[model samples]
Target: MAHETPRHWDRNMRERLRRGEAAALAELYDRFASLAYGIAQRVLDDEAATGAVTREVFGAIWESPERFDPRQGTMRAWIAGQAHQLAVARLRERAAGPAVREQVAAAATAARADYIVTAMPAPLREALELTRFQRQDYRQMAERLGINEDEARRRLRLGLQLLSSAAQYGAESADPTGGRPAPPRELGSR
Candidate 1:
Protein backbone atom coordinates (compact mmCIF):
# COMPACT_ATOMS: atom_id res chain seq x y z
CA MET A 1 0.00 0.00 0.00
CA ALA A 2 3.00 2.25 -0.29
CA HIS A 3 1.87 5.63 -1.62
CA GLU A 4 -1.52 4.14 -2.43
CA THR A 5 -4.51 6.42 -1.92
CA PRO A 6 -6.78 5.39 0.92
CA ARG A 7 -9.80 4.96 -1.33
CA HIS A 8 -7.83 2.79 -3.68
CA TRP A 9 -6.44 0.81 -0.83
CA ASP A 10 -9.87 0.34 0.68
CA ARG A 11 -11.31 -0.77 -2.62
CA ASN A 12 -8.50 -3.15 -3.29
CA MET A 13 -8.68 -4.55 0.19
CA ARG A 14 -12.37 -5.16 -0.12
CA GLU A 15 -11.91 -6.89 -3.44
CA ARG A 16 -9.09 -9.01 -2.09
CA LEU A 17 -11.09 -10.03 0.93
CA ARG A 18 -14.06 -10.84 -1.23
CA ARG A 19 -11.83 -13.14 -3.22
CA GLY A 20 -10.85 -14.95 -0.01
CA GLU A 21 -7.29 -13.82 0.01
CA ALA A 22 -5.48 -14.60 3.27
CA ALA A 23 -2.77 -12.08 2.55
CA ALA A 24 -5.34 -9.30 2.41
CA LEU A 25 -6.62 -10.21 5.84
CA ALA A 26 -3.06 -10.38 7.11
CA GLU A 27 -2.35 -6.93 5.73
CA LEU A 28 -5.47 -5.49 7.24
CA TYR A 29 -4.69 -7.03 10.61
CA ASP A 30 -1.16 -5.72 10.51
CA ARG A 31 -2.41 -2.23 9.76
CA PHE A 32 -5.18 -2.05 12.35
CA ALA A 33 -4.51 -4.61 15.09
CA SER A 34 -2.83 -2.13 17.41
CA LEU A 35 -5.57 0.42 16.94
CA ALA A 36 -8.24 -2.17 17.66
CA TYR A 37 -6.35 -3.46 20.68
CA GLY A 38 -5.81 0.02 22.07
CA ILE A 39 -9.46 1.05 21.78
CA ALA A 40 -10.60 -2.22 23.35
CA GLN A 41 -8.01 -1.94 26.09
CA ARG A 42 -9.12 1.58 26.94
CA VAL A 43 -12.75 0.55 27.27
CA LEU A 44 -12.40 -2.90 28.86
CA ASP A 45 -9.13 -2.34 30.76
CA ASP A 46 -8.70 -6.10 30.84
CA GLU A 47 -6.00 -7.86 28.87
CA ALA A 48 -7.98 -10.97 28.02
CA ALA A 49 -11.14 -9.09 27.08
CA THR A 50 -9.19 -6.66 24.95
CA GLY A 51 -7.46 -9.49 23.11
CA ALA A 52 -10.75 -11.26 22.52
CA VAL A 53 -12.34 -8.08 21.26
CA THR A 54 -9.45 -7.51 18.88
CA ARG A 55 -9.79 -10.97 17.36
CA GLU A 56 -13.56 -10.65 17.17
CA VAL A 57 -13.35 -7.30 15.42
CA PHE A 58 -10.94 -8.57 12.78
CA GLY A 59 -12.83 -11.80 12.38
CA ALA A 60 -16.09 -9.98 11.78
CA ILE A 61 -14.46 -7.75 9.20
CA TRP A 62 -12.89 -10.68 7.41
CA GLU A 63 -16.15 -12.59 7.44
CA SER A 64 -18.13 -9.67 6.09
CA PRO A 65 -16.03 -7.18 4.27
CA GLU A 66 -19.16 -5.92 2.57
CA ARG A 67 -20.20 -4.40 5.89
CA PHE A 68 -17.42 -1.87 5.53
CA ASP A 69 -18.58 1.05 3.42
CA PRO A 70 -15.80 3.38 2.46
CA ARG A 71 -18.33 6.00 1.46
CA GLN A 72 -19.40 6.41 5.07
CA GLY A 73 -15.83 6.67 6.39
CA THR A 74 -12.37 5.25 6.18
CA MET A 75 -11.50 1.65 7.00
CA ARG A 76 -9.76 2.88 10.11
CA ALA A 77 -12.96 4.53 11.35
CA TRP A 78 -14.98 1.42 10.60
CA ILE A 79 -12.55 -0.79 12.50
CA ALA A 80 -12.40 1.61 15.43
CA GLY A 81 -16.19 1.94 15.57
CA GLN A 82 -16.61 -1.82 15.59
CA ALA A 83 -13.97 -2.26 18.30
CA HIS A 84 -15.57 0.47 20.41
CA GLN A 85 -19.05 -1.00 20.05
CA LEU A 86 -17.93 -4.45 20.98
CA ALA A 87 -15.92 -3.20 23.96
CA VAL A 88 -18.87 -1.17 25.21
CA ALA A 89 -21.10 -4.18 24.89
CA ARG A 90 -18.64 -6.22 26.90
CA LEU A 91 -18.41 -3.47 29.50
CA ARG A 92 -22.20 -3.34 29.75
CA GLU A 93 -22.26 -7.09 30.24
CA ARG A 94 -19.90 -6.93 33.21
CA ALA A 95 -21.46 -3.87 34.81
CA ALA A 96 -23.80 -4.50 37.75
CA GLY A 97 -25.27 -1.62 39.73
CA PRO A 98 -25.79 2.02 38.83
CA ALA A 99 -22.41 2.97 40.28
CA VAL A 100 -20.72 0.36 38.13
CA ARG A 101 -22.70 1.58 35.13
CA GLU A 102 -21.49 5.12 35.72
CA GLN A 103 -17.94 3.90 35.96
CA VAL A 104 -18.40 2.04 32.69
CA ALA A 105 -19.69 5.19 31.07
CA ALA A 106 -16.67 7.12 32.27
CA ALA A 107 -14.35 4.45 30.96
CA ALA A 108 -16.10 4.51 27.60
CA THR A 109 -15.86 8.31 27.56
CA ALA A 110 -12.14 8.17 28.23
CA ALA A 111 -11.75 5.60 25.47
CA ARG A 112 -13.61 7.84 23.06
CA ALA A 113 -11.35 10.73 24.03
CA ASP A 114 -8.33 8.58 23.35
CA TYR A 115 -9.73 7.68 19.95
CA ILE A 116 -10.51 11.31 19.19
CA VAL A 117 -7.01 12.45 20.06
CA THR A 118 -5.54 9.61 18.06
CA ALA A 119 -7.65 10.48 15.03
CA MET A 120 -7.20 14.24 15.17
CA PRO A 121 -5.51 15.95 12.23
CA ALA A 122 -1.76 16.12 12.55
CA PRO A 123 -1.44 19.83 13.31
CA LEU A 124 -4.04 19.84 16.03
CA ARG A 125 -2.70 16.59 17.47
CA GLU A 126 0.78 18.03 17.57
CA ALA A 127 -0.40 21.20 19.30
CA LEU A 128 -2.28 19.22 21.91
CA GLU A 129 0.66 16.84 22.40
CA LEU A 130 3.01 19.74 22.96
CA THR A 131 0.74 21.22 25.59
CA ARG A 132 0.08 17.93 27.31
CA PHE A 133 3.42 16.20 27.12
CA GLN A 134 5.87 19.07 26.82
CA ARG A 135 3.90 21.40 29.09
CA GLN A 136 3.96 24.13 26.50
CA ASP A 137 1.81 27.23 26.35
CA TYR A 138 0.43 28.51 23.05
CA ARG A 139 3.42 30.77 22.43
CA GLN A 140 5.80 27.99 23.21
CA MET A 141 3.86 25.59 21.06
CA ALA A 142 4.04 28.08 18.24
CA GLU A 143 7.80 28.25 18.57
CA ARG A 144 8.07 24.47 18.66
CA LEU A 145 5.72 23.91 15.71
CA GLY A 146 7.14 26.81 13.68
CA ILE A 147 3.75 28.37 13.41
CA ASN A 148 2.45 31.70 14.71
CA GLU A 149 1.02 31.87 18.21
CA ASP A 150 -2.50 32.42 16.89
CA GLU A 151 -2.29 29.33 14.70
CA ALA A 152 -0.94 27.35 17.62
CA ARG A 153 -3.80 28.57 19.79
CA ARG A 154 -6.28 27.71 17.09
CA ARG A 155 -5.00 24.19 16.64
CA LEU A 156 -4.92 23.50 20.35
CA ARG A 157 -8.41 24.89 20.79
CA LEU A 158 -9.76 22.85 17.91
CA GLY A 159 -8.10 19.72 19.22
CA LEU A 160 -9.50 20.32 22.71
CA GLN A 161 -12.95 20.96 21.33
CA LEU A 162 -12.76 17.63 19.53
CA LEU A 163 -11.59 15.91 22.71
CA SER A 164 -14.44 17.50 24.66
CA SER A 165 -16.93 15.75 22.41
CA ALA A 166 -15.87 12.40 23.86
CA ALA A 167 -18.65 12.59 26.45
CA GLN A 168 -21.31 13.05 23.83
CA TYR A 169 -19.86 10.20 21.81
CA GLY A 170 -19.89 7.99 24.87
CA ALA A 171 -23.45 8.99 25.70
CA GLU A 172 -24.59 7.66 22.38
CA SER A 173 -23.47 4.19 23.48
CA ALA A 174 -23.75 4.55 27.27
CA ASP A 175 -26.97 3.08 28.67
CA PRO A 176 -27.60 5.45 31.58
CA THR A 177 -25.11 8.10 30.56
CA GLY A 178 -23.57 9.83 33.59
CA GLY A 179 -19.89 10.53 33.48
CA ARG A 180 -17.37 13.31 33.45
CA PRO A 181 -18.47 15.80 30.80
CA ALA A 182 -15.21 15.53 28.96
CA PRO A 183 -11.55 14.57 29.16
CA PRO A 184 -9.77 16.24 32.05
CA ARG A 185 -9.14 19.95 31.74
CA GLU A 186 -5.65 19.54 33.13
CA LEU A 187 -3.17 16.74 33.58
CA GLY A 188 -3.64 16.99 37.34
CA SER A 189 -7.43 16.92 37.05
CA ARG A 190 -7.50 13.23 36.20
Candidate 2:
Protein backbone atom coordinates (compact mmCIF):
# COMPACT_ATOMS: atom_id res chain seq x y z
CA MET A 1 0.00 0.00 0.00
CA ALA A 2 1.28 3.48 -0.89
CA HIS A 3 1.71 5.78 2.16
CA GLU A 4 -0.57 8.83 1.86
CA THR A 5 0.95 12.29 2.41
CA PRO A 6 0.03 14.17 5.62
CA ARG A 7 -2.24 16.71 3.89
CA HIS A 8 -4.12 14.02 1.98
CA TRP A 9 -4.51 11.91 5.07
CA ASP A 10 -5.87 14.83 7.15
CA ARG A 11 -8.27 15.88 4.41
CA ASN A 12 -9.64 12.36 3.99
CA MET A 13 -10.00 11.91 7.76
CA ARG A 14 -11.82 15.22 8.11
CA GLU A 15 -14.24 14.24 5.36
CA ARG A 16 -14.92 10.86 7.03
CA LEU A 17 -15.29 12.56 10.39
CA ARG A 18 -17.86 14.97 8.93
CA ARG A 19 -19.76 11.92 7.76
CA GLY A 20 -19.78 10.67 11.43
CA GLU A 21 -17.71 7.60 10.66
CA ALA A 22 -16.30 5.90 13.79
CA ALA A 23 -13.31 4.66 11.82
CA ALA A 24 -12.26 8.23 11.15
CA LEU A 25 -12.20 8.90 14.90
CA ALA A 26 -10.24 5.74 15.50
CA GLU A 27 -7.70 6.76 12.88
CA LEU A 28 -7.46 10.24 14.35
CA TYR A 29 -6.91 8.78 17.84
CA ASP A 30 -4.30 6.39 16.53
CA ARG A 31 -2.49 9.28 14.84
CA PHE A 32 -2.73 11.95 17.51
CA ALA A 33 -3.26 10.37 20.94
CA SER A 34 0.45 10.42 21.79
CA LEU A 35 0.82 14.05 20.75
CA ALA A 36 -2.20 15.04 22.78
CA TYR A 37 -1.01 13.09 25.79
CA GLY A 38 2.45 14.66 25.57
CA ILE A 39 1.05 18.18 25.49
CA ALA A 40 -1.30 17.45 28.40
CA GLN A 41 1.42 15.79 30.48
CA ARG A 42 3.79 18.74 29.97
CA VAL A 43 1.22 21.15 31.31
CA LEU A 44 -0.39 19.06 34.09
CA ASP A 45 2.59 16.96 35.34
CA ASP A 46 0.27 14.46 37.10
CA GLU A 47 -0.59 11.16 35.41
CA ALA A 48 -4.30 11.25 36.25
CA ALA A 49 -4.83 14.86 35.20
CA THR A 50 -2.84 14.36 32.00
CA GLY A 51 -4.96 11.32 31.13
CA ALA A 52 -8.16 13.27 31.76
CA VAL A 53 -7.06 16.15 29.56
CA THR A 54 -6.05 13.82 26.74
CA ARG A 55 -9.39 11.96 26.91
CA GLU A 56 -11.38 15.21 26.99
CA VAL A 57 -9.57 16.58 23.93
CA PHE A 58 -10.28 13.44 21.92
CA GLY A 59 -13.84 13.38 23.21
CA ALA A 60 -14.37 16.92 21.99
CA ILE A 61 -12.97 15.98 18.59
CA TRP A 62 -15.18 12.91 18.45
CA GLU A 63 -18.25 14.92 19.33
CA SER A 64 -17.56 17.86 17.03
CA PRO A 65 -15.30 16.82 14.20
CA GLU A 66 -16.85 19.38 11.87
CA ARG A 67 -15.63 22.10 14.24
CA PHE A 68 -12.16 21.54 12.80
CA ASP A 69 -11.69 23.87 9.89
CA PRO A 70 -9.02 22.73 7.44
CA ARG A 71 -8.37 26.35 6.44
CA GLN A 72 -7.43 27.37 10.01
CA GLY A 73 -4.65 24.87 10.89
CA THR A 74 -3.49 21.28 10.68
CA MET A 75 -5.24 18.61 12.79
CA ARG A 76 -2.10 18.06 14.88
CA ALA A 77 -1.90 21.74 15.87
CA TRP A 78 -5.60 21.88 16.70
CA ILE A 79 -5.43 18.77 18.87
CA ALA A 80 -2.36 20.06 20.70
CA GLY A 81 -4.10 23.38 21.35
CA GLN A 82 -7.12 21.59 22.74
CA ALA A 83 -4.96 19.45 25.02
CA HIS A 84 -3.02 22.46 26.28
CA GLN A 85 -6.19 24.42 27.09
CA LEU A 86 -7.74 21.51 29.00
CA ALA A 87 -4.53 20.81 30.90
CA VAL A 88 -4.13 24.45 31.90
CA ALA A 89 -7.70 24.57 33.13
CA ARG A 90 -7.08 21.49 35.26
CA LEU A 91 -3.86 23.02 36.62
CA ARG A 92 -5.68 26.23 37.54
CA GLU A 93 -8.30 24.26 39.47
CA ARG A 94 -5.58 22.30 41.28
CA ALA A 95 -3.70 25.51 42.13
CA ALA A 96 -6.85 27.08 43.56
CA GLY A 97 -7.70 24.02 45.70
CA PRO A 98 -5.60 25.10 48.66
CA ALA A 99 -6.98 28.65 48.62
CA VAL A 100 -10.54 27.36 48.53
CA ARG A 101 -9.80 25.05 51.43
CA GLU A 102 -8.21 27.89 53.41
CA GLN A 103 -11.24 30.09 52.93
CA VAL A 104 -13.51 27.28 54.12
CA ALA A 105 -11.26 26.58 57.13
CA ALA A 106 -11.21 30.26 58.11
CA ALA A 107 -15.00 30.40 57.95
CA ALA A 108 -15.32 27.24 60.05
CA THR A 109 -12.84 28.53 62.64
CA ALA A 110 -14.72 31.83 62.87
CA ALA A 111 -17.98 29.97 63.44
CA ARG A 112 -16.42 27.84 66.18
CA ALA A 113 -14.95 30.93 67.83
CA ASP A 114 -18.37 32.61 67.69
CA TYR A 115 -20.00 29.61 69.31
CA ILE A 116 -17.45 29.57 72.13
CA VAL A 117 -17.90 33.30 72.73
CA THR A 118 -21.69 32.99 72.84
CA ALA A 119 -21.57 30.18 75.38
CA MET A 120 -19.34 32.09 77.77
CA PRO A 121 -20.55 33.74 81.01
CA ALA A 122 -22.02 37.17 80.24
CA PRO A 123 -19.17 39.31 81.63
CA LEU A 124 -16.45 37.38 79.79
CA ARG A 125 -18.47 37.36 76.57
CA GLU A 126 -19.08 41.08 76.83
CA ALA A 127 -15.41 41.84 77.40
CA LEU A 128 -14.35 39.59 74.46
CA GLU A 129 -16.96 41.18 72.21
CA LEU A 130 -15.76 44.65 72.99
CA THR A 131 -12.02 44.01 73.14
CA ARG A 132 -11.53 41.29 70.54
CA PHE A 133 -14.44 41.59 68.13
CA GLN A 134 -15.02 45.32 68.35
CA ARG A 135 -11.21 46.06 68.50
CA GLN A 136 -11.59 48.20 71.59
CA ASP A 137 -8.72 48.92 74.00
CA TYR A 138 -9.17 48.06 77.64
CA ARG A 139 -9.56 51.72 78.68
CA GLN A 140 -12.14 52.28 75.94
CA MET A 141 -14.03 49.15 77.00
CA ALA A 142 -13.92 50.34 80.63
CA GLU A 143 -15.24 53.77 79.65
CA ARG A 144 -17.93 52.30 77.42
CA LEU A 145 -19.14 49.93 80.14
CA GLY A 146 -18.82 52.53 82.95
CA ILE A 147 -16.32 50.34 84.76
CA ASN A 148 -12.82 51.01 86.13
CA GLU A 149 -9.71 50.19 84.06
CA ASP A 150 -8.53 47.45 86.45
CA GLU A 151 -11.87 45.62 86.22
CA ALA A 152 -11.85 45.86 82.44
CA ARG A 153 -8.35 44.43 82.30
CA ARG A 154 -9.30 41.61 84.62
CA ARG A 155 -12.40 40.71 82.59
CA LEU A 156 -10.37 40.68 79.35
CA ARG A 157 -7.76 38.37 80.90
CA LEU A 158 -10.39 36.00 82.27
CA GLY A 159 -12.19 35.96 78.90
CA LEU A 160 -8.96 35.05 77.09
CA GLN A 161 -8.22 32.30 79.62
CA LEU A 162 -11.71 30.81 79.19
CA LEU A 163 -11.43 30.92 75.38
CA SER A 164 -8.06 29.16 75.51
CA SER A 165 -9.46 26.45 77.78
CA ALA A 166 -12.44 25.95 75.45
CA ALA A 167 -10.16 25.56 72.41
CA GLN A 168 -7.96 23.07 74.26
CA TYR A 169 -11.01 21.12 75.40
CA GLY A 170 -12.30 20.94 71.85
CA ALA A 171 -8.94 19.68 70.59
CA GLU A 172 -8.67 17.03 73.29
CA SER A 173 -12.21 15.78 72.83
CA ALA A 174 -11.79 15.36 69.08
CA ASP A 175 -8.46 13.51 69.43
CA PRO A 176 -8.52 9.75 68.79
CA THR A 177 -6.80 9.29 72.14
CA GLY A 178 -10.19 9.90 73.86
CA GLY A 179 -9.02 13.00 75.81
CA ARG A 180 -7.16 10.84 78.31
CA PRO A 181 -3.56 11.35 79.29
CA ALA A 182 -1.32 8.64 77.82
CA PRO A 183 -1.04 5.74 80.22
CA PRO A 184 2.35 4.66 81.53
CA ARG A 185 3.36 1.40 79.84
CA GLU A 186 4.74 -1.62 81.71
CA LEU A 187 8.39 -2.37 80.84
CA GLY A 188 7.52 -5.85 79.54
CA SER A 189 4.57 -4.68 77.35
CA ARG A 190 5.00 -4.86 73.58
Candidate 3:
Protein backbone atom coordinates (compact mmCIF):
# COMPACT_ATOMS: atom_id res chain seq x y z
CA MET A 1 0.00 0.00 0.00
CA ALA A 2 1.13 3.55 -0.78
CA HIS A 3 1.11 4.49 2.93
CA GLU A 4 -1.74 6.96 3.10
CA THR A 5 -1.23 8.17 6.63
CA PRO A 6 -4.09 9.48 8.74
CA ARG A 7 -5.09 13.14 8.34
CA HIS A 8 -4.16 13.85 11.94
CA TRP A 9 -0.66 12.53 11.31
CA ASP A 10 1.65 15.01 12.97
CA ARG A 11 4.24 16.40 10.60
CA ASN A 12 7.80 15.14 11.09
CA MET A 13 10.05 17.92 12.40
CA ARG A 14 13.31 16.26 11.30
CA GLU A 15 14.21 19.06 8.85
CA ARG A 16 14.10 21.51 11.73
CA LEU A 17 16.37 19.16 13.70
CA ARG A 18 19.44 20.02 11.62
CA ARG A 19 21.38 21.55 14.53
CA GLY A 20 20.51 18.90 17.08
CA GLU A 21 17.57 21.11 18.02
CA ALA A 22 16.24 20.60 21.54
CA ALA A 23 12.87 22.14 20.69
CA ALA A 24 12.37 19.74 17.79
CA LEU A 25 13.10 16.77 20.02
CA ALA A 26 10.74 18.20 22.65
CA GLU A 27 7.98 18.48 20.05
CA LEU A 28 8.63 14.92 18.96
CA TYR A 29 8.51 13.85 22.61
CA ASP A 30 5.25 15.71 23.14
CA ARG A 31 3.76 14.08 20.07
CA PHE A 32 4.76 10.49 20.82
CA ALA A 33 5.11 10.64 24.60
CA SER A 34 1.83 8.87 25.34
CA LEU A 35 2.58 6.23 22.77
CA ALA A 36 5.99 5.52 24.20
CA TYR A 37 4.72 5.42 27.78
CA GLY A 38 1.78 3.21 26.88
CA ILE A 39 4.06 0.77 25.09
CA ALA A 40 6.32 0.77 28.12
CA GLN A 41 3.42 0.26 30.52
CA ARG A 42 2.06 -2.68 28.54
CA VAL A 43 5.39 -4.41 28.50
CA LEU A 44 7.14 -3.60 31.76
CA ASP A 45 4.01 -3.15 33.91
CA ASP A 46 6.25 -1.56 36.56
CA GLU A 47 6.12 2.22 36.95
CA ALA A 48 9.88 2.52 37.29
CA ALA A 49 10.61 0.06 34.50
CA THR A 50 8.24 1.88 32.15
CA GLY A 51 9.88 5.21 32.89
CA ALA A 52 13.30 3.67 32.39
CA VAL A 53 12.28 2.21 29.05
CA THR A 54 10.98 5.59 27.89
CA ARG A 55 14.11 7.36 29.05
CA GLU A 56 16.40 4.89 27.33
CA VAL A 57 14.42 4.97 24.08
CA PHE A 58 14.37 8.76 23.84
CA GLY A 59 17.84 9.12 25.23
CA ALA A 60 19.14 6.81 22.51
CA ILE A 61 17.20 8.77 19.91
CA TRP A 62 18.63 11.98 21.20
CA GLU A 63 22.16 10.63 21.00
CA SER A 64 21.72 9.37 17.44
CA PRO A 65 19.22 11.69 15.77
CA GLU A 66 20.58 10.95 12.30
CA ARG A 67 19.47 7.33 12.61
CA PHE A 68 15.95 8.44 11.68
CA ASP A 69 15.67 7.91 7.94
CA PRO A 70 12.72 9.86 6.58
CA ARG A 71 12.75 7.86 3.31
CA GLN A 72 11.68 4.82 5.28
CA GLY A 73 8.61 6.43 6.88
CA THR A 74 7.41 9.29 9.10
CA MET A 75 9.27 9.91 12.37
CA ARG A 76 6.30 8.85 14.52
CA ALA A 77 6.07 5.41 12.96
CA TRP A 78 9.79 4.82 13.24
CA ILE A 79 9.96 5.94 16.85
CA ALA A 80 6.85 4.03 17.92
CA GLY A 81 8.20 0.92 16.27
CA GLN A 82 11.49 1.26 18.12
CA ALA A 83 9.83 2.00 21.43
CA HIS A 84 7.36 -0.83 21.07
CA GLN A 85 10.08 -3.34 20.18
CA LEU A 86 12.31 -2.36 23.07
CA ALA A 87 9.42 -2.20 25.53
CA VAL A 88 8.21 -5.62 24.47
CA ALA A 89 11.70 -7.00 24.93
CA ARG A 90 11.92 -5.56 28.42
CA LEU A 91 8.44 -6.85 29.31
CA ARG A 92 9.21 -10.35 28.13
CA GLU A 93 12.28 -10.44 30.36
CA ARG A 94 10.41 -9.47 33.51
CA ALA A 95 9.47 -12.09 36.10
CA ALA A 96 5.76 -12.54 36.58
CA GLY A 97 6.04 -10.56 39.77
CA PRO A 98 4.25 -8.10 41.99
CA ALA A 99 4.83 -5.50 39.29
CA VAL A 100 2.66 -7.45 36.87
CA ARG A 101 0.03 -7.99 39.54
CA GLU A 102 -0.05 -4.30 40.49
CA GLN A 103 -0.41 -3.29 36.85
CA VAL A 104 -3.34 -5.71 36.51
CA ALA A 105 -4.84 -4.21 39.64
CA ALA A 106 -4.72 -0.72 38.18
CA ALA A 107 -6.36 -1.93 34.98
CA ALA A 108 -9.07 -3.77 36.90
CA THR A 109 -9.87 -0.67 38.98
CA ALA A 110 -10.16 1.39 35.80
CA ALA A 111 -12.50 -1.20 34.21
CA ARG A 112 -14.65 -1.30 37.34
CA ALA A 113 -14.89 2.49 37.36
CA ASP A 114 -15.71 2.55 33.65
CA TYR A 115 -18.36 -0.11 34.14
CA ILE A 116 -19.94 2.15 36.76
CA VAL A 117 -20.24 5.34 34.70
CA THR A 118 -19.95 4.86 30.95
CA ALA A 119 -22.57 3.44 28.60
CA MET A 120 -20.67 0.21 28.21
CA PRO A 121 -21.62 -2.79 26.07
CA ALA A 122 -25.17 -3.82 26.70
CA PRO A 123 -26.07 -6.38 29.38
CA LEU A 124 -22.52 -6.71 30.75
CA ARG A 125 -22.76 -3.25 32.24
CA GLU A 126 -26.18 -3.97 33.66
CA ALA A 127 -24.88 -7.21 35.13
CA LEU A 128 -21.87 -5.54 36.72
CA GLU A 129 -23.97 -2.84 38.29
CA LEU A 130 -26.59 -5.21 39.64
CA THR A 131 -24.13 -7.77 40.94
CA ARG A 132 -21.50 -5.35 42.15
CA PHE A 133 -23.50 -2.26 43.11
CA GLN A 134 -27.01 -3.43 43.90
CA ARG A 135 -25.44 -6.30 45.90
CA GLN A 136 -27.60 -8.85 44.17
CA ASP A 137 -26.76 -12.52 43.71
CA TYR A 138 -25.27 -13.92 40.49
CA ARG A 139 -28.47 -15.56 39.20
CA GLN A 140 -30.38 -12.30 39.66
CA MET A 141 -27.60 -10.16 38.14
CA ALA A 142 -27.30 -12.69 35.31
CA GLU A 143 -30.64 -11.50 33.98
CA ARG A 144 -29.42 -7.92 34.24
CA LEU A 145 -25.80 -8.46 33.11
CA GLY A 146 -27.08 -10.37 30.02
CA ILE A 147 -24.68 -13.30 30.07
CA ASN A 148 -25.74 -16.76 31.13
CA GLU A 149 -25.89 -17.11 34.91
CA ASP A 150 -22.72 -19.22 34.77
CA GLU A 151 -21.00 -16.55 32.70
CA ALA A 152 -22.12 -13.87 35.11
CA ARG A 153 -20.72 -15.90 37.99
CA ARG A 154 -17.48 -16.32 36.11
CA ARG A 155 -17.17 -12.58 35.52
CA LEU A 156 -17.84 -11.85 39.15
CA ARG A 157 -15.24 -14.34 40.23
CA LEU A 158 -12.67 -12.89 37.81
CA GLY A 159 -13.34 -9.37 39.00
CA LEU A 160 -12.96 -10.37 42.62
CA GLN A 161 -9.75 -12.26 41.80
CA LEU A 162 -8.31 -9.23 40.03
CA LEU A 163 -9.23 -7.00 42.97
CA SER A 164 -7.76 -9.48 45.41
CA SER A 165 -4.65 -9.86 43.27
CA ALA A 166 -4.22 -6.10 43.31
CA ALA A 167 -4.54 -6.03 47.06
CA GLN A 168 -2.05 -8.85 47.32
CA TYR A 169 0.30 -7.13 44.90
CA GLY A 170 0.21 -3.99 47.00
CA ALA A 171 0.63 -5.85 50.26
CA GLU A 172 3.28 -8.25 48.95
CA SER A 173 5.25 -5.91 46.74
CA ALA A 174 4.62 -2.76 48.76
CA ASP A 175 6.47 -0.90 46.03
CA PRO A 176 5.20 -0.35 42.54
CA THR A 177 8.85 -0.27 41.59
CA GLY A 178 9.85 -3.76 40.47
CA GLY A 179 12.46 -4.32 43.15
CA ARG A 180 13.33 -8.02 43.47
CA PRO A 181 12.18 -10.78 41.17
CA ALA A 182 8.97 -12.57 42.11
CA PRO A 183 8.97 -16.22 43.12
CA PRO A 184 7.54 -18.80 40.74
CA ARG A 185 3.78 -19.58 40.95
CA GLU A 186 4.50 -23.31 41.20
CA LEU A 187 6.36 -22.71 44.43
CA GLY A 188 3.48 -21.87 46.73
CA SER A 189 3.90 -19.24 49.46
CA ARG A 190 7.23 -19.18 51.27
Question: Relative to the unseen true structure, what is the C-alpha lDDT of residue 126 in candidate 1, on a scale of 0 to 100?
Answer: 90
**Residue-by-residue lDDT tens digits, candidate 2, 1-190:** 9998867777777888878899888888998999999999998889998898888988887788877776788889899989998999888878877566455545544655566677667877788889877999999999999999998998888777655554444444344334552322221122
TM-score of each: 0.50, 0.50, 0.42
Number of clashing pairs, model 2?
A: 0
The superposed Cα distance between candidate 1 and the true structure at residue 55, in angstroms, equals: 0.4
Measured by TM-score, how close is model 1 to the native structure?
Answer: 0.50
- Model 3 lDDT tens row, 75-170: 778777888888887766566576776676666556544533343343444555676679899987777656587888766664554334434443
After TM-score superposition, what is the CA distance of residue 21 in candidate 3 from its true location, in Å? 1.0
Residue-by-residue lDDT tens digits, candidate 1, 23-99: 99999999999999999999999999999999999999889999998888889999999999999998987877677
Model 2 residue 66 lDDT score: 78
Task: List per-prediction Cα lDDT, in the order shown.
Answer: 0.86, 0.77, 0.64
